[model samples]
Target: MNRLLCGLAANPALPPELVDRLIALAATPPGPSDLPDPAGLSADYLADLLVRNLSERADLGPAQVAALAALDEDTPAQLAHSGHLGAGDVDPAVWPLAALALLDEGRGLPEWARRFAADPDPSLRQRLASCAGLPADVEDTLAADADPEVTAELAWSTTSAPVAARLARHPHAEVRQSVAGNEAVPPASLAALLTGHGLPPARSCLVCDGREIPFAHDPSFQDVDRDLPAGAGCDGTHGSTVHGTWARALSNPAAPPEAVAGFAGHPSVWLRLAVAEHPGLPAEVYARLAGDPAPRVRAAVARNPGTGPEVSRVLAADPEVDVRRAVAHHPRVPFDVLGQLTPTTRLGPHPLPPISAATPEELARGAASGNGRVRMLVAHRHDLPPELRDRLAADPDASVAKAVAPHPGLSPERLRAMVALHGQQVLARVAANPDAPGDLLAELARHEPSARRALREIASHPNATAEALLPCLADGKSRVRAAAHPALPAAVVVGLLADPDPEVVEAAAGNPSLPPAVMAQLLP
Candidate 1:
């Protein structure tokens, strides 16, 4: 009997009404069986299996999802784990359970987050605050939340610059301090905190638990705090740890050059070190720090963008090997001086200086250099002259070829030649290029087995045609991208709605090609 039911459920020709009846039968408990069969098949197990199979169907809509959730205590969670449930799918009665399941698994969608943000329960709102990649409006609503803890949590985890700025002035000291410590906090806010100007005054010491005693009297006081002036603390010395805030602010990449320069002469070596590492430090300050006794500070200056040729030349010959190596990597370091330094140091993947900063002569010199690293560095520049670009594309070094393959200026003919010569090595780069022609991407998509990365890139490429994306749907590695591709046909997108991979299903459901009626059914 169970086998017959399974067979009927698997039949695509079965009508919706019959499928509904099958679902009802699966949800019902079986009566006692008098005779034992040769093959053991329990009704309860069959019911669970039927529900799983039904839930995996691409055509399972809101009504069906709601019905499935009502089948058993575990069904809501099972459906939630399937990643097919949208905001409007789960019955309101089962929403709390389904939401908790989704949030616990870190799979909560934007629609759910917007709904949860307005939820009266602080616990729910607090949980939502901790989630990363929140929508902009949701972030704004949470930023203004009455609960200090919610606002504080948002401040800590948010990568949004505007959100960080708003939270930097939060009424609660805890929230403000969290914003200060946040790496994304704007430079103006950090500088204000360092100068003891932006934060509101509080009666209690934030650093030492509101202690009234002088900072000097605190047993925990380190030499670092000795130089911090009175009242520099969040409110006063009593309310915040001035040095701690200063250090965090100064270390921020956005810290203002003028504000950082203020600390260039400070007593704290830590503060001085932070100042040295700042990329926008004034040239005069860079020169001054280059002569400092501390090797680490000088080394930092050597790597700083503001370090002029004069300072770089001095640092190039420094006794400290690290300082010399830093000078070798500095973009501002003269080409002649860069050649003199040791090539043994491994080049980091850090982005080279902007292309606008390089003169044509400098770029040509880098391209003509015997070192592949120099050629590779030159290849990263987007505005390379045609001759230089072709030269780098044909370079013997595979890395150099790979680097130049993504240049938008590369003609389709050149790109095809590179792929034929370098084969799979350069396919991903060519696929990733925004200017890669649709015809080329379509051709590259044919070699899917060997070009997995290229397929993934092609799936997301604006130039990718329906032809390029069709084959990617069968590949698990690129399924998510293919499901999200704008070029994917509505029929294909609908099929992906039942993808075994939860992320792929979610991507397919979100695809723009999915009908408005279908999207309306999916939305809360």
Candidate 2:
């Protein structure tokens, strides 16, 4: 009974009388004699579950909010936290707990919270500091507070440049460290810390100059070979505060050229690697780092957007595969260099930007390369000339032929020809193409001992006709996909709800053709 009520409560189209009845039932717990409680859940517990689920409904209005609020103290808090009740709808003065919960959840605060900046409770001031768009006077009061934690919280959260600058100079190390991490901290202040000028000597790590700990202990750098120049460590043991401050300052976009230049030559390879990736790096500094003994540093330089053509060409032929791969995608890499590197470069999930901008002649040259991998790269390009595409489609290599089969621009005649030549080899790719013709998809659907994987793609193809999908419903391999096809008759979709296979039933339930009335009935 509770399950049925929970389902009905979630239905947006549920009648108003049903909603009122559910709320009334929640107010009065069911007696032992009222119904069989097969689940053995207590009446009070079931009532609370129903009320909470009802509170989640977006359509709840003032009347529903009031009724739920009256059922229990927590319901009002839940209603306010759910965001269904506006400030005018629920009076915070009447339900103070609801108002406090709103503040704790980081939901919009009440206007009265403005006074919290000077509230005697430091925690309250700290919470108020985290809120956006605080009044200027309120902000000033919090920034001047005696509590370092309040100032630290403001330092980490503040967008105002002046507040960050002031906090950067705070005598307390914690507050200054927080300011160092804040994006709005002035570049000069970050530079000062990076250069160890304004930073206190007590905060400096004696063991490794704030460089060894991250490389030795940080998981992000675990793959880095410890034998590298950066890891010739005296000891990995050190306080994190000092090292963290320098790292955060170095990563800041506002980091000054002086700080960046200082870090480039730092003894720690980790520091040099960080500076190499900085987008605002000066050209001369970038060029200098390109020759860094560390391959990872060279790789970072290759990946840097500011790396110029000369540096790109240099990295293109570097001994390290990682460095070559990184420069292969660089937009500034010389065209001839990119052509030389394509055969060995593996395609990652991200498209190669440089190749996308390649000239037709360059693309043709790549298509005609002796290596199949080079031809495979050419086949992936969306702008490949038709003459070149057809020539590659007939390539002796099956993998190269498959690579070009899915190009949406492939003409229908070419798609058919590929299927006739390769048969099932290219059938799945043709079916997956968005531009695959309906007649071809229908023919593929009826092919003998059909490509099991291709049938699934054909079942969901937008161009699939009713005839194509109808046959799929009988094949267990494609039944679930067929059940979900929008082209399936509404009657057939509804009938699939009773399928023995749970997957098919779920697919049927999700089909848009299933009537809303049937959907409500099918719930639970």
Candidate 3:
């Protein structure tokens, strides 16, 4: 069996599935053994397994791990389990706190959290910060905790007012987001968030001029119109551009009513569009833009989030195709309005960004989106549960298969299946990746001679041609041919002069490496 599988078997804590794989590995005919040792399995098989699986014998009474190092696996169960960690010099990977947290699951949470909170490991402290509902002092301690992640959590918990009040200025952007989201940020602290330029608390419902809404990106790049190319700056005449740019800058959802009112009538349609589409704009602004002379302005109003479901009902009824289309896709449009607009095909000519994964249901629905890029995106989601990955594997689009091919999450059998079904072009991508295992390289070479040729080309040097003819002199595949002789190794060329293949005979005859005797063999 391979060293890695053996290593897993040696490790006591390893899952049973891994052990089963290890047993199968031992059964493979050991390769020529000439293969260079892989980094992940640098240790020889048996020793690696013993080290990784961790013999329980060491866990017994080893207050002194150095002494226990000599012990064998059959020592005892409690000794094995306890010795695994308390052995003192155990690998730091065995995070004591994460283990402590797991044990705390069925018991009093606060006590366990507090216990680990005081642990020396900074990483452990950081994890406990997410435990929430701690005493106020514990929250305060974590709020100012040196770790950015810990401090961010303290700022995020609503139960801890003290931590929130102080977290507004935390250097970490995520910490600031937690403080910004806290409703109790005593008005005085609001300016701090404004000055922070909305760093980490990236998502929110607030869309006022100075308030940063969470989850909003600079939508200036979305393709709202197919006729207009992305990033095409308007000649002061483009109302949609001006309005989108302006409305997105609102920090508060409900503006200082006056600043909100004047923007609706700005001379530029762009400015009017901005006011119309503002997520926070009051109904009065929507009423003004709904009747706007510029049809584009009305379209922006239909798409604006600040417009309520009651108002959307009226706008979806508009005669303009663009306006009705905009209303159909707006995130805030209630499902009932969506149903009314269903018969319309106004999904703008430009493709929309992949939809936000707002719900498990949305994610499930996304798997069915007809767009190739959208399907590709879903196929590669790291969080894609196993069943979905299989669906992606089965997707007819080679492009989607290519997207999913590199994920380590795929089982070896699945990867082999992909290589088999998808063809040589897919194998080239896998081979070119630095992280791909050499065994896979060998496997692909064994499967398709063309893949080896491609890989040989990729591995060749500047002096070598793209055909990768150099390695062929020694390649087991006699099809590699003598003329496939690489640029160097003068002695091989001398020997090749008598080759039966004319191409080999000709190439070797021309080589300066051939000695007089070998040169004589090439002549009449």
Report every candidate's CA lDDT.
Answer: 0.72, 0.72, 0.50
CA deviation > 4 Å runs, candidate 3? 1-97, 100-112, 169-174, 182-192, 195-281, 285-306, 309-326, 329-343, 346-524
The C-alpha local distance difference test score for the whole of candidate 2 amounts to 0.72
lDDT of 2 at 212: 44
- The local lDDT score (0 to 100) that residue 223 gets in candidate 1 is 32
TM-score of each: 0.53, 0.63, 0.32
Assess candidate 2 and give its TM-score to the true structure: 0.63
Candidate with better lDDT, 1 vs 3: 1
- Candidate 1 matches the true fold with a TM-score of 0.53
* Top-down lDDT ranking: 1, 2, 3
lDDT tens digits, residues 391-471, model 1?
888887877888888887788888888888888888898898888888889899996356788888998999999998987
Winner on TM-score between 1 and 3 is 1
Name the best candidate (by TM-score).
2
Looking at model 1, the pairs that clash are: 205-210, 205-238, 205-239, 206-239
- Candidate 2 residue spans exceeding 4 A from truth: 1-157, 170-182, 199-238, 265-270, 291-295, 357-432, 436-510, 515-524
Error of 2 at 514 (Å): 3.6
- For 1-524, candidate 2 gives per-residue lDDT tens digits of 34445445654555555567777767876676654434565666666767887888777767887898888767887887788655556555566456545655556454645656656878667866776666567677778888777887888888888888877777655576677778888887888767768654433232344364443443345433232233323343334555656766776778887677778877778778878888887799999999999999999899888789899988887889999998976765666676677666665533366667778887788788887766776676656777887888887766667778877677788778887777887777778878888888888888776787788888989999877788788778699889878888889987887787655765675576766676555433
RMSD of each: 12.2, 8.7, 19.0
